[model samples]
Target: MAIAIAADELESLFDALPDVVFFVKDAAGRYTHANLTLVRRLGLKRREQVIGHGVAELFPAHMGGSYAAQDRRVLGGETIDDQLEVHIFPNRAPGWCLTRKHPLRVRGKVRGVVGISRDLGRPDARDPTYERLRRVIDHLQQHYADNVRMAKLAELAGVSLAQLERHFRNVFQITPQQALIRLRIEAAMHALGTEGSIADVGVACGFADQSAFARQFKATVGMTPSAYRRMTSTKE
Candidate 1:
């Protein structure tokens, strides 16, 4: 025999989970429903405020624009699975999260998107393997402007190249190389907010050239660095 949970009960279960945000958006990218976790993370006093609102209404332009593009992708019948990316918390803190989005289909037509984002706790504090990987992550963060070597990271973690890749995937669901790129992209995002030249920002973030930085930045952020900088600058 098996037990079945009601719809409301299932929703309550999702609401009770800590550090997990859940949401549903319509084809137009309007919020149709959001869990309490999402509501709180958006700093909304009530879920009603989130209903019918778009990401642009709830978040800054740079972040919201990325989210809107993601919604469009899902609504176009695409599924995004277990992507490692940065998220903004309710208190305005930036953190990494494993995010997934799927298209909601009704009668074989894509109606909207349903998504969840699970916060990744401090990279250094997750477990013994993660603790070991922390040294590499810390070094990457500190030296994002310089070329990073996987062999050196493996050496720092007291592991071989294969083991380092395995551990990084097991613990962070990303390759060490991907993590390094993410770090550089994050650093570039921060640098874009300053008065520095775009090429200078790319150089500071370890890209081989401004073209390379723009390519990677657009791939990861869903917009060019110049567009992001313009949107964020206007917001500020």
Candidate 2:
């Protein structure tokens, strides 16, 4: 059954969260409703300014175009979950976030998209599972370039795969695999700033090959590795 709450209520509720950008987009991928955080990050003073605009209109050309493609996938009924992304918005801290988008359905028919991009927060160190997961996290940080295995992580956590997944999510807000990918991508991003070849950077970051690295890098960073290199170079 569809929830009875209205979109406006959801928008208002999300507005209290300054670290989350929340929105509802119509079938055409135009924003129908947005929270204050999203409006402000877009460099707008009012929600009305963001409404009726698509990502292609709100972000830079490259980033907006990539986001528009992602919207199309969600509008086609794909649910994007815990996708790590980099955001460089006006009047906001530049950092990585986890984004999720789900297709909104009405009467069993696809209607629109509802989503949120939340800034990555610190881990819950007070959680009982934190100590157990810390071992796994440390191993990843030390050997992110290696082909890390999930079974090894589960063993280190002293839990079954299912329990490890649950505990990791509770503490980190992302799956262990997602955590590993983030580590590798961050390493790659830093490596790209140097004089290293793009292929070498990909291999050094544990990706299977240059193509795989480029694909994942673009999806997460909203630009290709070469383009990212050029952007950084221009800023230098």
Candidate 3:
């Protein structure tokens, strides 16, 4: 309904979050409020173009436009939950969005719609036990900067620590702790490659100390953290 000059600072705080949340409107039936993460996933230039744009507007042309019915019901006041398969233009690579959609109420009546979506592209979300264990993974990924424990992960996943481990193995073919290590370490590597310092990368990815980060980095990437930074710098 309006051009997006700037994201409301109150709301844009969520944009810094890892989860890719954006508003979905029935009238436009496309995304408004596309967070930085969502835009990156779709390889889009800016969220500004999406504001006030319709599905018809997102794609110059698309096949079928299959989601209109589901959108109509939500706009008509029925809550719907589904995993959405959204089509991004160009290559049309499939993107999975775990979504819960409901009406946007104003005073007492519906105005439009609101939906929150989390991308499920990681190899981790493939578990048959995922609906059970992956919620833990989600929680950890969300608060990765904090002190997260196996017990906390288990509580979020609604399973015992042992059960969480088994389900994580069944789905991701790795132990839960191993999965956590891989995620954190890989996150550290990404931060380093993207212009973060050795200590900054370590802190952002949850290692409590630089020595520990260097130890884990060498074990995973066969190089110390400083060495990796030097190598990356040389290549650039």
Candidate 2 lowest-lDDT run of ten: 87-96
| Local distance difference test scores for all models | 0.80, 0.89, 0.63
Across 1-236, the per-residue lDDT of candidate 3 in tens digits comes to 23233334524765776666656463546655566665665567787766766655553322223345556678788996643333333453334345667886666776667766665545655556778765766776777767778898888777888888777766765566666776786677567777666888898898898888886665444446676566556663
Judged by lDDT against the true structure, how good is candidate 3? 0.63
List, in order, the clash count of every candidate structure: 0, 0, 0
Q: What is the TM-score ranking, best to worst? A: 2, 1, 3
**Best candidate, lDDT:** 2
TM-score per candidate, chains pooled: 0.74, 0.91, 0.45
Cα lDDT over the full model 1 = 0.80
lDDT of 3 at 168: 73
Error of 3 at 124 (Å): 7.7
Greater lDDT among 2 and 3 belongs to 2
